[model samples]
Target chain A: MITLKDVNKNYSSEVSIGPVDLEIPRGGITALVGPNGAGKSTLLTMMGRLLGIDQGAIEIAGMDITTTKSKDLAKIVSILKQENHFMTKLTVRQLVGFGRFPHSKGRLTAEDEEIISRYIDFLHLAELESRYLDELSGGQRQRAYVAMVLAQETEYVLLDEPLNNLDISHSVHMMQHLKDAAEQFNRTIIVVLHDINYAARYARYMCAMKNGKVIHMGRTEELMNNQILTDIFETPIEVISTPQGLLACYH
Target chain B: MNSTVALTPKPRTSRAPLYTAKLGLGCLLVLILLALSLLTGAFDIFSGEEGREMFAISRVPRTIALVLAGAAMSMSGLVMQLITQNRFVEPSTTGTTEWAGLGLLTVLFFYPSASILFKMSAAVAFAFIGAMIFFLFLRRISLKSSLIVPIVGIMLGAVVSSVSTFFALQTDMLQSLSVWFAGSFTSIYQGQYEILWIVLGVVIAVFILADRLTLAGLGEEFSTNVGVNYRRMVLIATALIAIATGVVTVVVGSLPFLGLIVPNIVSMFRGDDLRSNLPWVCLGGIAVVTLCDILARIIIAPFEMPVSVILGVLGATVFVGLVVKGGANAR
Candidate 1:
């Protein structure tokens, strides 16, 4: 379980996020969905302990993020941000090996290698494991990075915009993979998604935010109504029931 | 879907033999250069007692200084590039060497009789502070092109060097300052050159922290998320760079592009996994510097030219090539 209580971050005189109080339960997919500049990434990063909280507390499985040693926190939670750049040349397999750093500290054991291979296979990146990251396409690279985060084997996986550069089929594939990981591994996954339809399709829970505040938090079905999403996005959003599922169309 | 299919898992093959081969070749090259450097000086080692004394007191120490300073500076350059996430950044380019110079000048002005240890510590402190300032500036200004980083660093170095020049002129130490700035191993001896051994310790520490440094190069958020203390790693990298630069600057003066060019050249061949790339970087550094030192000795026989002059010509050419390559990549 992840908890944020009255958490705040002040960027400048005119920009600040939170006084947010929220709890994300353990297990399944919880999607944070909102428009741009809605502090989705900021909140996710703060929970990941990539960014420090100015006020209040965030706890991952009852361990206070602010007080917990980073090495300890790393075992319980892992985060993948949107933009990742590397100065060194690293193969996909080597990059995934870094996910075991908290445990192995660069000396990967046979067990660690087995786990790495499993995650690579899970992400369907076994063919590309020997390929350098710079040689891969954007979607392939994104999958490699996701594989790295999964190889961390953390209970709480927080991903900020995992679908940023992916195509339609890849996006769906990624969501399905995340869903399977969440269920099979019994891990809690919090993902910040841009496509409301994707969120509606795969997420078990939804947290809608606007102007740095969580305006709506409930079951995915409850948060799928037209009025709620329209208010949260400040746009005319129409929710129509299709044979596939509930889909929200803004255009 | 076919593309995503798993291949048969390849057996893990030990790279120890390949690494050993590379190490063997590198050591052979450095050893050859070391032999040439030891033999090329004014006194003949194949002769009598005076020649043996000269070999012991002068040539051997100078050769050792060449190896130590070379390896240390190049590793320093590699560390700086990793920390800054820029390819062109090095101790000289990033104002670190200039800051060390300023520290040396200040010490010379205030206490003319200061020990080498005091001078080196002062320089290290200033270099660390200077590198910290550069990082702070980097955080504030979001640069689009990687080329701008080194340009800004060079300008920052110019600013610091100007300050040193100003103080040197006022204190009437301009001539002495210029001589010190032109790096050479001519003055190195057993007594005066022992301080450079600190670089070996720094190199060992860097080897231990190699993996962390590579992770830190991935960016702050990713590094911290992976449980590497990003700030602590940066601080450690900064200290290593400062000590390497400070000790080298004090012992042999500033080797302008030795740091910049050596690492770039090594990475072009070995890639940038810090752990694997480290030994190659050190060996390449030692080889390049020793070769340059040999040239410096023979270029003006019986009278030596400063090693920095040769390095400057070679470094500037390679630096320009890198900028062009980087610009082409940006496009």
Candidate 2:
């Protein structure tokens, strides 16, 4: 379980994010969906302990993020941010191998190597495993990063826009993989998403944010309403039940 | 589709055979350079009885100095590059050498009778402070342009350098300062040259800490997420780099482009895994410095020029090449 108590972040005098209090239960896919500039990434970053909270504390599985040693907290939770750029030119396998640092501490045991390869194959990245990250396309690169976080093998995984440069098919594949990861590993996955329909499809719980605050939070079925969708997005969204499932259609 | 992969997994990527061959070639080249350094001095060791003494006193020490200082400075560049997260950053570019020079000058000014070890310490301590300042600047600025990082460092170095120049001019030590600071191995005899061995500890420490350093290289958030303390790693790296730079500056003055080019060249060929890149960077450093030092000795025949002159010219060409055509292998 992840809990945030009176969380606040002041970007400036003109902009600030919550005084937000939220309790995210363990073991399912929870999608943080919001319009642009909704502070969704900010909130996720705070929960991941990437960004410090101004006036609140975040606890992951009873371990206080501020006080718990980073090395200890890493085994319990992992985070993947939106933009990750570094000067090191690494292969796909090498990058994924880094995900096991919390467990292996840079010395990869045989088990660590197996886990790394498992995540690689899980993301359908087996073919590109030996390739350098710069050699892959954006969609392929995105999958590799997702593979890295999954390889971390933490109970709680936080991702900010895992589907950013992905095409429609790749996006579908990614969401399916995340859902599979959650169910199989019994992991708690929190993702910040821009696409509402993707959230509608795979999100077990929907946490909708608007203007720097979480406006609605409930089960996926309960939040899948036309009025609620339209209000949160400030667009004319109609929830249509196709054979595919519920989709929020704005266009 | 669940396929059973091997537990050990094959060696990463296409590195196994090619990496060994490359390191083997680098080792062979280092050996040849070492022989050349041993043979190409003013007195030929094979010719006379005093020649063996000259070789022992001067030639052998010069070669050791070249290898140690070479490996140390180049590795220092690697560490700086990793810490700053920019390929262009190194002791010379980041003004670390300049800061060390300032430290050297400040010591000489105050305690004109200071020992050589004292001088090295002051320079190293200043180098550490300078690197931390550069680190702080990087932390404060967003770095929209990658080029701006080196520019900020160069500008900061210029400020420190001018202060050194002012002090040098006032004390009438400017001429002596430039002479002592030139990247030359001319005065490296047995007694005074053993101080270069201190950096061997730094080189070994980098090897032991290679994995943690590489993790730390991926930036703060990534490392922190993986449970490594990013700030502490940077501090450790800076200290190592400062010691290398300070000691080298005190002993050999400054090798302007040794740090930047060696690591960039290695990464260009071998990719950027520092643990793997370590041996190559060290070998490349040894080869480049030995080759340049030989060239420095031979360029003027009976008279010798500073190695920094040759390094400056050659290093500038490669540095510019790195900048203009940088997008090739560099990401």
Candidate 3:
């Protein structure tokens, strides 16, 4: 379980986000959904220990994230941010191999290599494994990054905007892979997403934010109503039942 | 569906053939450069008895000095680039070189006959302080704009340089100051090169903290999230860089672009994995410096042009090549 208590983040004099208090239970997909500037990404990053909380503490899997040593914490949680721009020319396999750095310190054991291969296969990145990261298309690169986080083999995974720049087919594929990872590997996955329908479909639990605070939090089914959707987004949203599940239409 | 079906498990990268071959090639290049540097001088050192004495006193010390300066400056550059996450940064860019030159000028002006040891000590102190200031400036700015970092650093260096030049002119020491700031390996004797040991110590520190530097490059939040002490690591890296830059400047009088050229070339050949790239960068630095030193000796024949001039030309040429190649690669 991940817990945050009264977390406040002040970027500067004018912009501030949250004294937010929230709990994310273990063993499911929890999607953080909100419009731009809603602080959903900020809250997720803070929980992942990627960002510091000015006035609060975060605990991941009962370990205090603020005080835990970096190598020790790396074993428990892994996070992927929105951007992964590197000046290095790295093959996909070489890049994913870095995921084992905390464990092997760049010396990959056969077992480490095996785990890397498995995650690569899981993300359908096997064929492009030897290609350089800069050589791949946007969606392929996104999948490679996700694969790397999974290769980290941490109990909890945090991803900010995992679907950014991906096409619809790739988006669906990526979400399905995340769902599979959650169910099969029993890892707690917290993802910040812009697509509300994707959140409704794959997420077991959902947290909706407006400004900086969590405006609504509940099971996915409970949060998938037209009234809550419209209020959360501040736009006219209609929910229609589909064969797959409930889909929210704003346009 | 077709793409998913086409997926195949990736083969593991071995440390034997592929890695070892690259390592061997790097070592070979270094060894060849060392021989070339030892042989290429004014007195035909490879041919006769005068060769051995000249080899021991002049050629040997010169070669060792080049290797040490190259490795130290390149590693310093690599660390700067990593910490700042900007490609254009070097020991010179971060104001360490300028500060060291300033320190030297101040010592010369204040105590005209100060011992070399005292001068070097002052240079190290001033350079370290200047590096700290650079770090503080970086800390104050958001890491979101790393592109602005090199610009800020260059402007800071320019300010320090102008101040030093102003002081030099007032004291009529401008020529002496210009010679030291211009960067030449011509005056590096055995006693003079002793300060470079401090730079070697810094190289060891870089290796020890290599992991932290790599993590830090991922950004402060990510590094902190993974449990690194970001502020402490940055401070340590900055101090080491200052020492490296200061000692190199005091010994060789500053070698323009050795740091910038070596690391970028190494990164182009090898990936940016610092652990692997470091040794390669060190070797690459040694090669560039020794080769440039040789050219400086031979290019002007008996007159001997400064090594800094060679480095300036070489660095500028390589810088242009990298920009053009990077653009072409992007296309």
Candidate 3 has an fnat equal to 0.39
Mark the regions of model 1 whose C-alpha exceeds 4 Å error after superposition. Answer: B3-9, B12-18
TM-scores, in order shown? 0.96, 0.94, 0.90
Q: What DockQ class does candidate 2 belong to?
A: acceptable
Docking class of 1: medium
Candidate 3 lDDT over B1-331, as tens digits, reads 5545453353466221335777788889888988887778778776688777777877778888888888899999999888877777787766779998999889999998998888888888888888888878987987564446767887998999999999999999999998887777777766667667777898888887876787677567656645566788888887888888888887788777777888887777666767767778888888888888888888888768888888888787976676566557553
Q: Write down the lDDT of every candidate, Cα atoms only.
A: 0.89, 0.88, 0.82
Tens digits of per-residue lDDT, candidate 1, A181-237, equal 999989999999999999999999999999898988889999999999999888999
Q: Candidate 1 residues B1-331, lDDT tens each?
A: 7545544766531111236776888888889989999899777787899888888999999999988999999999999999888889999998999999899988988988999999999988999999999999899878777878888899999999999999899889999899889999989987999999999999999989988998998888878878999989999999999999998999999998888898888777756667877888898899888998899999998899999999999899999998887778673
RMSD values, in order shown: 2.0, 2.5, 3.1
Q: Quote the chain B TM-score of every prediction.
A: 0.96, 0.93, 0.89
- The better-scoring model by DockQ among 1 and 2 is 1
TM-score of chain B of 3: 0.89
Over 4 Å off, model 3: A9-19, B1-11, B14-19, B44-52, B112-115, B135-152, B325-331
